[model samples]
Target: MAEITTEDGVQIDLVSGERMKKLRSMEKIRLILDGVRDGNIVILEEGLSPDEESKLIEVTMTEISPDEFAGIEIESYPQQEPNPGFFSRLFGHNPPNKLTVIGPANRIETLHKDKNLIRALVT
Candidate 1:
């Protein structure tokens, strides 16, 4: 697993695989954003295309509040967490405490701090 720090200074972990494929999908990015808002770290397995990565970084930096400081980490192949019980899984789903991303190193640090840019990318 790879680790990254967001502009907000929050630490994140990344895991790549079939499981993360769904999470990285375009439609699910919004859900990912929602999860991030709750302090859940994201995990991208197959990694994102340059464009996708750019969009994600753009969206994330812009969406985050100025008072917040989160960081993102990237991992090539990460371990999976154990499954929770039925009740917890059904009604108490929790996002991972660490966030992660698996992709190019260059684009990782190009955090754009414009809200309009982030809204355009995320929406």
Candidate 2:
């Protein structure tokens, strides 16, 4: 991985969609976790699937410690489909989420999230 420098003590890694598409599920989780552990915010261009998000939380629980590591904060909104086709409705296939933000819980606070915006405070 290339080095990403922080400005004003904040580092934001914006992972692009093409880069994300090439990684496997576990790889994606590791990438996100590593950034959070290093006190950097990670933004995924194409958000993870529901299963992936759940697995991430599960992994994070195992890694949390009192002094060394804090848990992470994750936020995302599912992409809205203006109209669902009959098959989509019957199959329960929802569109993928638009983006994901992951960071250390103690450092990043999510103030608000709606369909179009996410307001976060980073320390």
Candidate 3:
């Protein structure tokens, strides 16, 4: 679970993987972009794929407005699998979902990011 607002009243939207799975790639991108435009930080329980992330950047480039909408800042880590069984090693099993954070470029700053942590500054 995630808090809707911080002490300074910054809005945050924590989206679950279940909800994300229900939306198409474009729909998911739109949702993140819209929230960023509204000055809200959006955290995805399951991060987007490489293709989807590229698409999001492409769409954001087209929608950037100098006075109104700044673009977005995004951070994510690759899925980690500590161990792989025989089947996973042979067949290549899917790894667990990763986390992602998206927000207005001007408002959010990624202080640090590693495989297991993402530290962000939101103003």
Candidate 4:
């Protein structure tokens, strides 16, 4: 087994799409916060909840510093993306949010060089 952490590389989590949506909004937010603090760039295989998205934006703004922000690039796809299509709207079916990369700017930058992290983040 290998250790997993932001320092090690881009940490990822595969959140259950159906289960997450069924959770309370606050629970979703808390779950996101925990992953953020843990230094794992949460890869929501499922889209994020509206409340979860709002809270993520708020926390990112507060938690990261200007200098750190410069070195750490954050990318996130809200569980709820922009205007979905008619079927997605009607069926409430949206693609899994997928990889939300977050970490030290330089570290994230080196992702291209790390095939392992790329594999983990992607697969």
TM-score of each: 0.37, 0.88, 0.83, 0.47
Number of the top TM-score candidate: 2
Displacement of residue 87 (Cα, Å) in model 3 is 13
Sorted on lDDT, best first, the list reads 2, 3, 4, 1
Question: Given candidate 4, what's the lDDT at residue 69?
Answer: 48
What ranking emerges by TM-score with the best candidate at the front? 2, 3, 4, 1
Q: After superposition, how far is residue 122 of candidate 1 from its true place, in Å?
A: 25
Candidates in order: C-alpha RMSD to true structure: 14.8, 2.0, 3.3, 7.1
Over 1-123, each residue of candidate 3 has an lDDT whose tens digit, in order, gives 364976768899999998989999999998899888999999999888777888999999999989998899999877877877899879866664489999999999999987778999988
Q: Provide the global lDDT of candidate 1 against the true structure.
A: 0.46
Give candidate 4 regions above 4 Å deviation: 1-7, 65-123
For residues 11-112, write the lDDT of model 4, one tens digit per residue.
755566666767787676667656656555554555554445656667666766665443234454444457788888898665544445544433444234
Tell me the tens digit of each residue's lDDT in model 2 across 10-108.
Answer: 888989878888999899999999889989899988888877888999999999998978899999988778999999999887676778989999999
Q: What is candidate 4's TM-score against the reference? A: 0.47
- What candidate 3 gets wrong by more than 4 Å, as runs, is 1-3, 6-8, 81-97
Q: Write the residue-wise lDDT of candidate 1 on 22-91 in tens digits.
A: 5545654564555456554555544454455557667766665545535332332222348767886687
Q: Which stretches of candidate 1 lie over 4 Å from their true place?
A: 1-25, 68-123
Q: What are the Cα lDDT values of the candidates?
A: 0.46, 0.88, 0.87, 0.53
For model 2 the TM-score comes to: 0.88
